[model samples]
Target chain A: MPDSEAAVRKRIRGLLAQLYGGDSFVETVSDGISLRQAGVSSHALVALLVAMEDEFGFEWDDDVRPEALRSIESLAGHVLSLQE
Target chain B: MSGYANLARLDLAYREDRRIRVRDGVELYYETRGEGTPITLLNAFFLPSPSWRVFTEELAGSYRVVGYDLCNHGKSSHVGPEPTWEEHAADLIALLDGLEIESTHLIAASTSTILARDVALRHPDRVRGVVLAGPVFGPRGMRRQRQVQRAWLRTLESHGIAGLYEHMYPEVFSAEMNEAIGTPGFLGFREAFSALSTVDDLVNGLNRAMEDVGDPAVLAGVERPALVVVGDDDFLMGPTAARELAALFPHGRAEIMPKAGHVPFVDDAEGFQAIVRKFFEEVDARA
Candidate 1:
């Protein structure tokens, strides 16, 4: 079954925390929080993509726009779109 | 010595040769200097380990510099044919194990970037950080590789190392260095690498090696702190690819050396050293 949008967001938040630092940054990645504003390095964004691929079993296609990696919400949306 | 047979042997005589046995019975030749954070110096396509003698001399004061000739290059023993980047990574693992080094920073240039990246992705835990100069990935900017290979092979087969130098000189060095190509260092580089043409194993490996790089997934998976340095005027890898490569790493950034070419360390050694030293300091601070 497909995970609900909220669950995907939560998982993404958890992955970001585990891969990057801790819960402090995880709490800030809400819909309004831009990844840049959240202090995400380009490295962290790539790591997030890799971690998501490991969790979701779907590799990111090259056609995906750079904007897709702009924020957690956008990333979650991209992941959900892939599932669908 | 087959490669050095016709060339002046004075410069080549200064380098001390040592060997280590990797898996599959391949012996790789390497050199080391100083004692600090272990930093492995990887060579460019045509140049051997001693090509890095000048750069290593400076870097050795601050870091444990391990400069090695990959299998089939320089004095390194060739197992059979050119090994894949994966196999090269395996050889590196064995080399590190043989040296009793668990983890180290990779300071690589040109095609060695692919080797470094393969090792970093395959064994992230064993890499502390990466510093790449004129870095090239396989899939990106690979369209020109075939042309390059054809040119290299033609140069090797036809005119010998002198012609090969004239063929590649413009692409490898800055315009300033090109103007003064007769300098001792530049002359030595031409003679030394030209001598490399006589080594049968180093021939015919370019196309195969270039094929193993440029995987987007693997690039994205490298989680180490990486500093990608490129010559501002480098047309081979270019600054755009350098920037893109840097962005692919989780903790990555790029620097462009003004008036430099593919071999920035040779073109602007002082500036390159400053940049690398600063990056290493930052990496050490983070550690």
Candidate 2:
């Protein structure tokens, strides 16, 4: 991964940990892991989005297709797209 | 009859019926009256269709006014394991599908405003415009509000109907209105309040559903034309919050009703109805 992609992934993993209270982000994302499978419930997903918005200063679009958030990598990619 | 003059001549007609098997397979209870463009009204927290009587009556002649009890409130069945805003939105979607409504305006008050925004964001095709009154995204400073809401819920669970009334009546409306309206309205309000007054009901479901609500960031994304109404004297949600809420909608405008409290329709039915009618007409004309 490029340095910027790696930093975004690190930030996402930290957010996931803060929201879900687990330390498996690195292990789980060895090949990337679905957020739902990583135990991110809808409630936690909302909290995560709130955290992301606070960190990035933008609103996360709720209307976006849920399938787009399949994994940490995908989630980071979505966030990066928003940043651009 | 002119819309404003027709206020006192209000006549209310409503139907209570069930329709089965939408594509989503959710059974819904829907009530409707009058004809023209359809307008769906979503009730505030713990309020039912009867509370919407004045607003509905005033608008019926000019538009199709439909309002339904969310699953756990009013006459609707609490057959579900739990209630969430998404489920509430889905129920609305199903109701529209069952009624064969292609597009309609949505007016929501209090907590239902949360659901209305969700529907507009997720199913924009079905929604032509929206009006959110006394909007509550999530309770600010969740810790304390959650505790109070939970305590109220527990009081209701243990005290049955009467206990719930004691805890909820003061917070819902002014103490003076409760005294003036006497036992009948108080009893009705109690019944409506208790229907969803439980900690589990709110914390696990309603609160979660409310999570997506009231954020200006979320409201800004809603491209539909919107009107926000707030009461100047509203004790629960004030004018400042209403102004903040209005700023969220890209096409949002706000009106403040003088001397009105939380439930503006109940507090000033005539003025409230006129504002609502005018807003709907303006949105329709623009469209």
In lDDT terms, which candidate is top? 1
Residue-level lDDT tens digits of model 2 in B175-285: 445445444334333333444335444433434533452445677678888787777766556777677667767888888877565566656666777888888888889
RMSD of 1: 24.6
DockQ of 2: 0.01
Q: How close is chain B to the truth by TM-score, in each candidate? A: 0.88, 0.80
Clashing pairs in 2: none
* Native interface contact recovery, all models: 0.00, 0.00
For all candidates, state DockQ relative to the true structure.
0.01, 0.01
Off by over 4 Å in 1: A1-84, B1-11, B138-141, B182-189, B197-199
Say which docking band candidate 2 falls in.
incorrect
| Residue B148 lDDT in candidate 1 | 73
